[model samples]
Each structure stands twice: as structure tokens, then as C-alpha cells.
Target: MKRQRNRGRVTLASIAAMCAVAALPGQAHAADDPAPYAFDPEAATVRGTETNAEASELKSGSVYRSAIKPGQKLYYRLNLDDDTNAYVSAVAVPPSGGKVAYGDGITVSIRDVDDTQCGSEDAIFGSGEFARPIAAYAHRVIEKGNSTCREAGEYNVLIERKSNATSSPDEWDLELRYASEPAVKAADAQETEAPENWSSASPVPPSGGQKRSGGSSFYEATGLETGEWHDTIVPGQTRFYRVPVDWGQQIFATAALSNNPKSTEYLGNALSLSLDNPVQGHVDDTTLSYSGEPASVALDPLPPVDYRNRFASASDVSAMRFAGWYYLSVTLSPEVAKSYGDEAIQLRLKVNVRNDPKASPYEGAAGIFGVSDEDKDMAKSGQSAPQAAQSDTMKLVAAAGIGAGAVLVLGLGAWTLLARRRTAPAAVPAAAGGQQPPYGGPTRTW
Candidate 1:
């Protein structure tokens, strides 16, 4: 009988151990899963319609969330007056681990009620061909003497995804933003041409910076000022940061990756750094081949922000036409993991902002183009607008997990105690001094 009880106790303990082990793998798998885009919690969810007649209206200064599938063309409505310039940007986020081709991308355009296209732009996966967030923007500028899309009573935004048959079948999530810029006062409406002469030389990035963590998406991007910042990134991860650039100011940035002592294998295009304008328009990008040694890439010299830069023939100059939060994204190729041991590589950013801020000429709602004191404060704290909500969500999840774990432990303990009692004979009388026996004892330790 003693032998049987001991065996039963061992069996119950083994079963409990197995159950605990089984629960761990699921949690580990979830932790390893790719993180999804962090869309703004306050953003309204809207459905894209197939036709303009049924298109949903997009309000200015608002962010929206939607989705797009392969070969799908969707339309959203916009109501605007003739005086304001309308800028619309669409960001497509492909599922992580999904196969994407070089040609896969998204196109955005703005058209009038009569189907005349006001502006259109497309963004592709390019040589990287990796699953990531790609952004493009279209605008209906209130240009003088441009008769095409100036009168914007009822305009439509057309968004389409381009994908081949071999691409992933998963639907891409979309983030859309609409910004309306009021026309400049007549006295301030002089034609401001792009800079005639500016230094094309690259500025040296600052060294020995404060530590900062980059956001996973534009909405969650960490705010940065002109300075040196440091962070860490693992293979297959892309981190995003934003800098405030006001009119007449220019931004110069450089990204550097630290050497990895674990591996010296050379990988081509192992790192990339890209810059996007306030409206999410691509400005410039550079890549570096890594051989485990330190490597760096700096953006090409860009013109200062000016309203009249829209007339410039070069795309890079034109992209600097507006002033706001310019996004910087740094990506470490997934291939690096094979040789770099999946360890995080140290990253440093040298950022410089030049020129004094200029006064805006807008007669209405021009705050979006300039940086505010609050913006600087946020940057100093390295917090995004939605970070508080994200923190709250994490706290709730942790609390629930703790509550569940307590119940599980308590229930398992009770079951083990009950099983031991049922399998054992009635408790034996205590030894002469009321002490429990050493073998087949009734005293419970758990």
C-alpha cells in the first residue's frame, strides 16, 4: 500500500509538470509571431467601396483605417473647397513572412467628380522585395492657372494594390490620412522658387547619443529632434522615427550599424535607410552591404522646405515642399540572421537640422506645417501620441495573465492534495510525541 501511494503521487506530479510545460510553448509561439502595424486607436474604421457613388467620405485632418486585397481598386470620397490644397496619403502594410515581388506595390490618386485625375503617385517594393510598409501620396494642389483639379467640390481618392499571382494572398492593411492646407494670403503668395544654390555635401552625423527606441509604424514612430540617437535592431526588423522640420529648414540624417563579432560573413544589401516626407512621399533611400563590420549610409542632400518647391522638376526637391514630421526608417535584412546569430545589432543615427524656421503664409489651418513647443516636449520624452493607450493595453493583458496563473496554481495544488488523500489510508496516529512519521507521512508540504 505504501508503494502504491508513492507511485500515484509521482504520477500526479508528472501529469502536473506536463501540463505546465504544454502551456509554455503556446506563449512562446505567440511572442515569436510578427508584430502587426500599430494603427491609431482613435482612427475611424472605414470600408472602401468599389464605386465613387458608394465611396465613404474622408474628413480632413483625420486618420482612417481600411484594407485592400490583390487587384482591388477602392474609392473614398472627399469634400473640399476651391481654396484649400488637399493632400491624401495611403500606407499599405503587407503581412510579415508573406512573399512579395519587386513589382508589388500600391498606387494612389485624386480625381474630380468628372473623372479628371488631379494627381497620382505609386510606390513599389523595389529591389528589397521584402514584406514591409509602403507609402504613396496624391494631392490636389490649388495651383494658380492650373485648370484641371482646382475646383474640388466633390473629389474621390482612388487606391489600388498591384500584385502578381505568385504574391501572398493575404490582404494588406491600409492607413490613410487627409490634410487640407489653406491657400496663402494674397500678399504672401509670391512664387517662392526652389533654392538656387545649396551645399550638396553631406553633414557629419553626431556621435555619442542618448538611447531611444524606435516605433514599429508611422503612427507609433518615436519623435526625434536634431541630434544623435542610438537604438538596437534585430534581423528582419524595421524601426521608424520622425523628426520635425519646419519651413526653410533642412534635415540631414545618417544611419550606422555596429560590427558583429559573432560573424564576418558578407551579405549584400543587408541594411537600408529611407526617408519619407510629411505626406508619406518617398524622398530618398540608401542601402549598405555588411560583412559584420560597421557600415553607414547617408541620405543625399535635400533642399529646404518651401511651399513653392512643388514646381521643382526633381522629385527629391518637390518632396521637400512641405514641413512637418519627416519619417526615417531603418531596416536590417532578414538574411543577416543566418550569419549574425539573430542577435540585435547596435544602431546609431546622426541627425542635423539646419536653417531657422520661416513664418508660414497660410490664412487657415497651417499648424500641421510647423513644429510646436509641445512637439519638442514630446520628442524629448521619446513618446508618440498613441503610446499611452498602448501601455494601458499591455498592463491589462499582464494583469489578466497573473490572475489566470494564480487560479491555475491553486487548482493544481488542490487536485494533488485531494488525490493523495483518496489514495492513502486513513492518517496514522502521530508517533509518541505527536510527530509525523518519516515515511508515508500525512503532513502536507505543498
Candidate 2:
């Protein structure tokens, strides 16, 4: 609620995941747990909805500020060169209060300029514990695959507000982004480093940023450094943060959900934490759900980078051939949000970025949003580019792993990971002199 907004459960996949994570070296002075996250409001959003052009032409590598009215839809056209893949995303702000049905929330899809559907996907939500004042993200990818709508041309992306929305339609803010990935080199597609996934989340100096109340949107994500971060989320809501995972540094993170009986009862498998690579691809996702116990997901650290790497794998962290601002996504479904205490669910997010921070691979390139210019050129080739290669085969996909009671299921192929277990992430010792996070706030008397 502080910085712009700022801000888990486990499901069945925890059981299927092997918990053999190697312990990180013991910390001497570093706090293992994340202190409350700090907040900073950066970059005013540029609105793109003033002109409701369904075919408003958009460049392939850019982020747009846009909004939609009730039952209204906004469209942007992207011109893609043959052999290149396209990645696009839309983040929508959730209105506060009321029952939000999962089936009719947000839908994003790609089509030709004339409106023939190339491919489309709907967005879904988990239960929530509160009335809702959060945000959700929807993404779609048009790869250079041999599919129906993958060829070069002007493609339109539609951001639609379904008639099924229970709350009155308000002007919703949307952050839209699209990246064009060039083709990859044949040699790089075969070049990959498969080291044993590192398991240590050793304590370190707290990175910058003071605790912020709400970072529930792309425009409001709390800025995260190399240390652990702390925030709270209501069910049916999703919180997003921007992490500076510089090139050459490997980043490891975990989400620890409070296990109070009242909280745990409705939280079974409702927790999920995911890492989105620089281009917003859902590469590494860890999910768990349980009816009677606390839940956590230990995301293996991402390895350092090089241009010679394949972009596809069970874990997308290591698949990064280049580096920029990677987004960290945490979600608690609507069903889970409904039962969370009125105050919201408390969470300790442990993040460890090994190696020092450096400039992003795309920092000085053509773009400023971290979608590198070099990557876009390589996208034309289709194999060497990280986002482009995946574009050929996968759409911008969302991961889902739902838990029933204590049962764990690996139902979502794109969202599942071959995770080995480590102890719950909160095991880190607190930094010296730091105090437990304050749970009370200023009294509001009318």
C-alpha cells in the first residue's frame, strides 16, 4: 500500500518435488529472512487509452500505457517480420470489493489486423481472502512456429473487459508490453549449462527499499535488491515486484505463507511464487497447497548468463541467455483471498542474488524498458534469441497448480517445475538490531 502499492500458499506439487536442495552456507551477519520491503515510486505511466483505436499501430519492442472502460476493449497492432516471435503482456488493476468470478476476468489474444484470431487465452484467478484491491496480469505470445498466425504481418492484440465482471466497470489501468525476438543461432540453441540447481539462500546485507504497503501492479511493483523482501497479499489478488537480477548473477527466491490455523484452513495449495524473465516469460514457477500445514516454494537460483543458451526447459531461470529487469510474481487466488484475515496474509519472501550487480544486457541497447535491441535483432533468426525461440513454440503462458486438501497435483505442464525440497525458507536468522515487522497501523477515527 505504500510505494505505489507493493506488496503465498503451497499446493500438491510440493510433495512431488524432491526436497534435496543443498543448504546455503551459514550466515554470520546476514539476515536470512526478508525485512519489510521498502517502496519507491518511479516512472509515471503514459496513458494509451485516449484513442480507442483497435488497430492503433504499435512498435514491436515497446511498453504502452493504456486503459479500458466497462465492456470496452482496446486493440494495438504490432508488425512482426517473418522469422521473428512476439511476446506481449497486459496488467489490469482490480477494483476493491465484491465477488470476482474467475471465468470472466481478463482475456488477451493475438490476431491479424482484420480480426481473425491467431491465438487467444483467458486469465483465471484463485480464491481471495478479502474484498479485493489488487491487480492481475494477462499475456499472449505469437511465436514464429508453423502455426496458423505466426507469420510476418500486422497482428492485433485485444485487451477485453468481459461482460461477466461482477463489479461496475471502471476505467482500468493497463500496462502493455511486447518484445520481438529474433531467430537464434544454431550453435547457441545446443549450448546449455545444466549445473545442479543451487539450493542455498544464505543471508546477506539488506538491499535498498523501505517496506511499502501495496505493490499490486506492474506500475507499482516494489523495487527488490539482492536480499530478502517482505509484503502481504489478499486472496484472489496478485502482487508484482521488479528485481534487478543483473547479468552474471544467479537469483534465488522463496515465498513463506503464514500458517495460523484460521489462515491455513483456506490456504491449502493456494500459494504460488513465480519468476518472470526479462521479457516477462513464465520460466520458473513453484507452487504448493496443503490444508493443515505451512507452505513454501524454494525457487532454484538462476545461473549466470551468456548468449549461447537454449530458452526452453522445466526451469526457465537458467534459460536466460541475457539479463535485464526480471519480474517476480506472487499470487493468492480468490477462493483463498476470501478467507484470509481482513488485514491480508503476511508473507516473508527470501531472495538471494549471487554475484554482483552489473548493467543489463539490454541496458544501453535500443530500448529503455530492458527489452534489448540486440535481442530483437536475434529474434529474426529465431534460435539464438531467448524470447524469440520460445515464441516459435509457446504462447505467453501462465502457470497454474491448484491443490485440493493435502493433495498435490502436477496438472499444469507449463507452470510445473522439477523441484527438490529444502526446508521452509524462513529459516534465515534475522539481521542483527532489526525488529520483527509491525502488524498495527495508524488508527483512523472519523
| Candidate topping lDDT | 1
Kindly list the per-residue Cα lDDT of model 1 for residues 1-446, writing each as its tens digit. Answer: 65456556655655655454443311211212334667766679999999899999999999999999999999999998877788999989888768888799999999999999998888887777667787889989876667888774899999999998999989999999998776787865667455677766666666669987887788778888878998888777778898988888889999999999988898877888889988788888878789989998788889888877888878778888877889998877788888987777889988998889988767765667767777777777776656534444456555655655665676677778877876554456555787656765465534
Which ten residues in a row are the worst by lDDT in model 2?
20-29
> What's the lDDT of the predicted structure labeled candidate 1?
0.80
Question: What C-alpha lDDT do the candidate models reach, one value each?
Answer: 0.80, 0.50
Check candidate 1 and list the clashing pairs: none
TM-score of each: 0.77, 0.50
Best by TM-score: 1
Give candidate 2's error at residue 339 in angstroms.
Answer: 5.9
TM-score of model 1 (CA atoms) = 0.77
Model 2 agreement with the true structure over 42-67: per-residue lDDT tens digits: 22344443233535666666666666
